[model samples]
Target: MTAASRPVALITGATRGIGRAIASELARTHHVIIGGRSRAAVDAVVAELGDASAFVADLAELSSIADRAAMLPELDVLVHSAGLIGPHEPIAEVNVDDLLQVFTVNVAAVHELTRITLPGLRARSGSVITINSGSGFTSHPNSSVYSASKFALRAWSDALRDEERAHGVRVTSIHPGRVATDMQQELRAMEGGEYREDDYLTPAAVAQAVRLAVETPRGGNIDELQIRPQ
Candidate 1:
């Protein structure tokens, strides 16, 4: 297919980890646009994927997100992969600021970006995928803050799928369990556990799950997928 004919995909947090893998996978079939906080990092990924481009901005900033998203004339696929996981503490120890930072990046940004891109997605009968976590379905002892954000994300994705069904826009939430990324390593250290790559799922595996959801035939939608390490 020509450049104009190929599907367009914009993946956030694509400079590293699962987002990077997803970008690489979609670059095979879509004109992947790498989104990240660092211009250099986004540019690097764009170079890595010869057919890809860049969308650099801090997702926590709604105005920047609006400005960046407006540049796109149309989008076929939008993958929300950027997230923040932190303040692993009990409710008593957690503060509103911690909730604010986590929720801003994980929930609010996804909501904002999707809101701005709905027109493009509707125009193209596109798909939206949110890289959620198993924590979304269940809350752990000290990770309630992160879990809360993921839970909210899951709820939003569900509503989005329903709201956009008539517009021919598919929404999917992929809940992964402990992927072997830098974030997982940090989470392990925080939990006082040894970080073992062998025990965790690979980013490529998660990417494959995303590919499956986006590639599903148009007559159907993969509303939610939960992937865990075997």
Candidate 2:
């Protein structure tokens, strides 16, 4: 099928982890656009997923995001999987720079990208799925900054859902428990413990949640989904 005729999905952080899995899953039915910081990495994933394209953009860099968003004509699905896990320090020890950086990527970027893409999404009656974390609803020791960013994300998703419902767009926040991705490995290492893959959910599992939200009927909106390891 020609690219113009197929449904299009743009997945940020598509180079690895849950983003990559979502890209792969959507590629079966949609023309996936792989969004990532590294062109080489995006290209590699595109090569792996035959029916996909690449749009390289670093969420941390604000200037280029607008330009990249303009390149997209219309988008059917916008999956926000690009995020940062800030320093795991107690509130007393948390660095201001670290907090700002985490919020910039996890919150601001998501908001701006959605804003820029709103027209296209509204035109297509699309779906927006954000990969929020279980930390969004609860906080643990030394996780204040990360949790705060996620809480902000949750608020954004909620507001967006209400605002876009009249336009026939679906907004969903997916809060997944610890996923056995490289990020989890890093978190485990920071805690000075062994990283066990079996202890967490796979990226594919999280990707399935995204697919379910996207595939729901236009009249049905799955606003929030929380998946945890059994």
User: On residues 91-185, what C-alpha lDDT tens digit does candidate 2 reach at each position?
Assistant: 99998999999999999999888899899899999999999999999999988999999999999999999999999899999999999999999
| lDDT of model 1 at position 35 | 93
Cα-lDDT of candidate 1: 0.92
The segments of candidate 1 whose C-alpha lies over 4 angstroms from its true place after superposition are 1-3
Report the number of clashing residue pairs per model: 0, 0
- Residue 71 lDDT in model 2? 82
TM-scores for all candidates: the values are 0.97, 0.97
RMSD of each: 1.8, 1.5
Clash pairs, candidate 1, are none
Total clashes in model 2, counting residue pairs 3 or more apart in sequence or in different chains: 0
* TM-score for predicted model 2 compared with the true structure: 0.97
lDDT for 22 (candidate 1): 96
Give the worst 10-residue stretch by lDDT in candidate 2.
1-10
